[model samples]
Target: MIHWRVSLSWILVWSCSLLVGIAILCFGYFDNMLSHFQQLEPSKIEHVTQAAAKQETLPRLHSSKTGLALESQAQKEKVPNKATLTYKDFPSPVQGKILRGIGNCYLAAIESYMFHPGEDFLEPEGTVIRATHRGKVIFAGHDPLLGEKVVLDCSQGWIVTYGCLENIWVKTGENVEKQEMLGQVGFNPGAEGINDQPQLHYEVRHGNTIQNIETGGSNL
Candidate 1:
């Protein structure tokens, strides 16, 4: 019994010594860390804080730049081209009355003979004539039969012909938009005869097929 009691006392002493050593080690470690922090200058502290703030802001800056780049690319793609036009995107070529309708039973300008292939518009002399739709000019010159004429290939197998125009501004192979002025109304002496009235011979075609504007059969 005496031996067991002596062994217990020794064990208790060892445990107490271990706990005290651990406490001293913990206190010494904390004291060293505190001293290191206290030794730093104000400038060093400010620099460390600023560096941490910059690190936090970097991700947001990168995200904003990426977003702006994506938006710019989308805007570029959204830009329209000639192929963007639909068949019905055209407006009237001239603001005037339809002097001769489209069909076979129409008066020939130079003579009293019937059978006209296209519609005719009568306007005052020098009136502005505009493009029916966006297209590229394929012919811009005087035709012996049509007078001063401008022909445009408006895409989708469609073509527009403007006759009896003066002061032609667009040349062949030039791109034109809807309602853009191509020339001014001019006299068709053959059609007007002694009266000398200003007139525009407008025609729309789809793959060699002529379309009637009033009947909506012209493929627009």
Candidate 2:
């Protein structure tokens, strides 16, 4: 009976030991799986972040490239060449009789009547003014006397001015071509000052001096 009791106690102790070992193995396996999942979670998060960043940056890059291409094209179109162009070939915005010519440049001392400087084409109000040449816009804004005005500096000693405009379509330093719409003619309250008439005032200046539109063989 004593030997049987000792054998039974040893058997119970071995069983308990085997159960503890199995539990430890199972816990270790599950812990390893959890650690692997945590590592994969960070990798997935990084991938998603990188993808989002690319999506955000690509559209802006495309837009910038497109804008640069457009500006380059406009610049290319503004290059001017010297050619004999007539006013009949050129379209006029205002359709009226020639008003007054730039009579003379009055120097304080000298009273010599030089040839008229610029020709004045007087058209009724609301005429769509067009650009005379292909060039970059030098000025497009308002003045106290001119009202809304646009000036184009066609390279090679040609500059055109449109006055009494209702609105300006292009801004300063913009590229424009011949016959392009500069603006529309409007009534300037200060054109005649006292005798305000609804008319379009146009001028062409070469270098510092104004060119006579009539005698210059440039007609409206």
* Cα lDDT tens digits for candidate 1, 38-152: 8999999999999999999999999999999999999999997645543355546666878776655523564466556577787888888888787899999988756898999
With a 3 Å backbone cut-off (N, CA, C), the pairs that clash in candidate 1 are 211-218
lDDT per residue for candidate 2 within 1-220, as digits (tens), equals 9999999999999999999999999999999998886778777979988999999999999999999999999998998755754443334455687655566433222334444344456666777788867778888888776678888877766777877788789999999988889888678775332146666667786666655555655322
Q: TM-scores for all candidates?
A: 0.56, 0.50
Best by TM-score: 1
- Candidate 2 residues lying further than 4 Å off, grouped into runs, are 1-93, 104-117, 191-194, 217-220
Where does model 1 exceed 4 Å of error?
A: 1-87, 105-115, 191-195, 218-220
Query: C-alpha displacement of 50 in model 1, angstroms?
Result: 49
